[model samples]
Target: MSLALDLAPSASVEVRNVDLAYTRKARGTAPLSRFAVQADGAALASVPDEMEVRSSHLVRFSPTGKPATLQTYSVETLRKVEISTSGDTFIGSTDDDLYVFKDNKKSRFLSDRRANYTDIALSESGSRFGTVFCDMLAAHHTVALGDQTGRTLWTKDLPFAASAVAVSRDGSVIAVGGEDGDLWLLDNARNTVLKHRQEAAMEAVAVAGTNRVVFASGGGAGVINAEGQLLWFTEIVGETVALGTDSVARTVAVLARTDTNAGRLILLSGENGLPVWEIDYEDSRPTGLSVSANGEFVGVSLRDGTVCVYKLFYGDRLAAADGEAVLAEARAARSGDGSLLQAVALLQARLGSVPSDFRACDLLKETLTDAKEQALALSANAEEIGDFLSA
Candidate 1:
C-alpha cells in the first residue's frame, strides 16, 4: 500500500516504554512466529460477575494493564462508561439517565427523560467532560462540555450527529467529530482551532497529549496539531470502524473491517501517522479498541464475543500461524519453479512491513540455499539455468 504524509517525518520517533507480551526463542531450527492471538490477559484485580459481564458492552484497562474497576461506582447494564484521567471520578450513562460517582457518592446528573446520550468523554483532571446528546422527541443534536457537577460550560448545535468527542489532557482544548464527516477542534471558550472534513463518517476521534487531534473513518485517518496544521493523513484500505489512541506514546490503533468481515488492526505513529505495526484477523470484525499502559498493550473486542490483547513490541512467544504458514510455503519453493516468483513476492511483502522478525530473515537465507542445492542437483540432461541469485 502507498502512504503519503503531509509533513516531512522526523529523524526517528519511538514509543516510550514499549513492552512485548509474547516472546520468541531459538531453541532449535523451528522458531516461533512473531504474532499470536492470546487467549488470556493481564492479572485481574476484580471484575463483574457473569450477569454483569453479559450486560456490559465496553471494557477498560488500567495503567498497569489490569481491568479497571469503576471503584465505588455500581455497575450493571450500561450504554457507556467513562472515567476521569486521574482515576478518581467516574461517570456512566444508561438507557435513560447519567450518573457520576465521586467522593463516595453517586449522583444522578440527568433525570429520566426522552433525551439520549450517545457519547461521553472526561478530561484528564476530572474537572470537565464532553458529550454528544440526541433528543428522541425530535431530530436535534448537540455537543457540550460539562463540569464534574454536570454544569454545562459550553455547548453548540452540530450539523450532524456528533458520534465522538475528546478533551485534551490539559482540558483547554476539545476535539469533536460528527457523522456529517466534519471534525472540529474547539477551545475551552468555544473558539474553533481547526476545521476538517472527510469523505466518510468520522467515528473515532481523540486529542493527543501534545494538543494534537486525530480523526478517522471509513475514508481514512489524519492528525492535526493545535496550531491548525495537518500533520499527516493517509487513506486506509478498509472501513475503519473503531480506534484506540495513546497520548503518552503518541500512537493510534485502528481496527478496520476488510473483505469478508476480516479485521485489520494497524498501529500508526502519532508523529507522521505512519504504520508502526499491523496484524490481521479472520471472520470476525473487531468493533471495540482500547490502548493502555503507554501503548504497551492493545486490547480489542471482536464481534464473536471474544477479546484479544497483544503487545506492541518484539517478544519470544511465537504463535502467529498465518505468518508462519507464509514463511513455510516460501521455504518449499525452489529455482525455475512456478512458485518461486510467488514466494519472492510474499517474502518481499513480509519484509516490507516496518518491523520484521528474525525467522523471516532466516527464511530468505534458507530459500537461496535451497535453490542452490536444487540447481547443483540438476540432471545431466537438464539444461543449466545459470548462477543462483543472492542478495
Candidate 2:
C-alpha cells in the first residue's frame, strides 16, 4: 500500500510499497522494501515499521525545520499508539506490548499482560519517554523511560484514564491530561503529582518552556504557571480542541471546534491570555496541529491529508527585541556576574513600581533571588540565600 501527503504549498511527503506482514527485519539488513517517501518530487528515505508495517511511519521534522529519519513500529495498524522524534521512538501494540526503537534497533520495553500502554510521548530532547498504561481494573499507570538504559526508571499510579502525556523540554515535569477532564503534573524525579485541576473538560495539554502549562478546555482555554496558579483564561464560542505554546514568541495557539464551523485557530497573547488573531477553517477538520516552542512554525494537518505549515513573523522588531533583552538579562543575572547585578536591580525596581502589564513582572522574584545570590557571594555574606528565596 501507499500514501501520499501534501505537507505544504509546494511540498509533498509520500510513502509507498509498505509491507503488510509485521516482521522484525534483521538490523543492518536491506531497509524494508515496502516503504518510500518523496518530498517535493525528490526521493526521501523511507524505513517501514517491523515486517507487516502495521504502524504509522512518522516523518518528524527536526527542531531546525528539516525532515529527519523515518520511524516505524510493529503493531496492527497506525492505531497502535506510537510517537517518535529524531533520536528515539516509542511504540505500544494493541495487545499491550511495549517496545522502544533507537539507533535503528528495536527492543521490548515491557512484555507483560499488565503492560497495556495507552499513550506515549517523548521529550523535546528525545532523551526521555513517558507512557500511560492500564492495570487489571482499567486504572492508569505511568512509566518514565530512562535515556541511558531504555528501562522504566520511574513509575506512578494515576487517578484516571490518561488520554495524553507530555514531558517538558528540560525533563523537569511530566503533564498528563486524562479522560476525567483533569490535568495532573508529575515531578519526574519522584513520579508524584505536583498539581491537579479537575474543573475543565480538557481535550489537550502541553508544557510551554520551563515555567508554564497551557490546556484546551471545554470552557475556553487556560494557562497555569509551575505553581499551578491559573495564570489566564479566555472565553470561546467553541470547545478548545487543541493548545500549544511557542516559547520564542511567548504566545499560545488554540484550535476550537464548534457545531457550525469545522474548527478555528486562535493566537493568544501568552503573557495575558488575550486573543490576538483568529483564523477559521470552514470546510476541513484539523487532524493535528503542532507549534514549535519558539513560536517560529505552526503545522496544521487536515483530515483530507494535507498539512499546512505557517511561519509566524512578529514583524515588530522593537517589541521582539525588547522581549529578547529581558530574557538575556534574566540569564545573565543567574550567572553570578556583578556586571548584570545593576541591570537586574533595574529590572526588579521596574517590576516593583510598574503595573502588571508585562510578563516580566511575574519573573521579577526569580530575578532578585538569582541576582542577590551572585552579588552576596562576593560580599562574604553568602549563606546560599536559600532563606531569602524560600521567603
In model 2, where do residues sit more than 4 Å from their true spots?
1-56, 60-75, 80-97, 140-149, 191-193, 259-261, 315-391
The Cα error of candidate 1 at residue 353, in Å, is 12
lDDT of candidate 1 over 35-151, digit per residue (tens): 111123331111234444433212233334444444433555555556554445656677566776566566766454456787777665668777778888538888778778766
| Model 2, span 33-137: residue lDDT tens | 000111111111223444454444545433234454465544443333323323344443354655666665666665434666666555655566676777756
The CA lDDT of each predicted structure is: 0.60, 0.53
Which residue runs does candidate 1 get wrong by more than 4 Å?
Answer: 1-5, 8-11, 14-47, 51-72, 227-229, 259-262, 283-285, 302-309, 314-391
Error of 2 at 216 (Å): 2.0
TM-score of each: 0.67, 0.60
Cα distance off (Å), candidate 1, residue 234: 2.3
lDDT against true structure, model 2: 0.53
Q: Where is the poorest 10-residue window by lDDT in model 1?
A: 27-36
RMSD of each: 10.1, 20.7
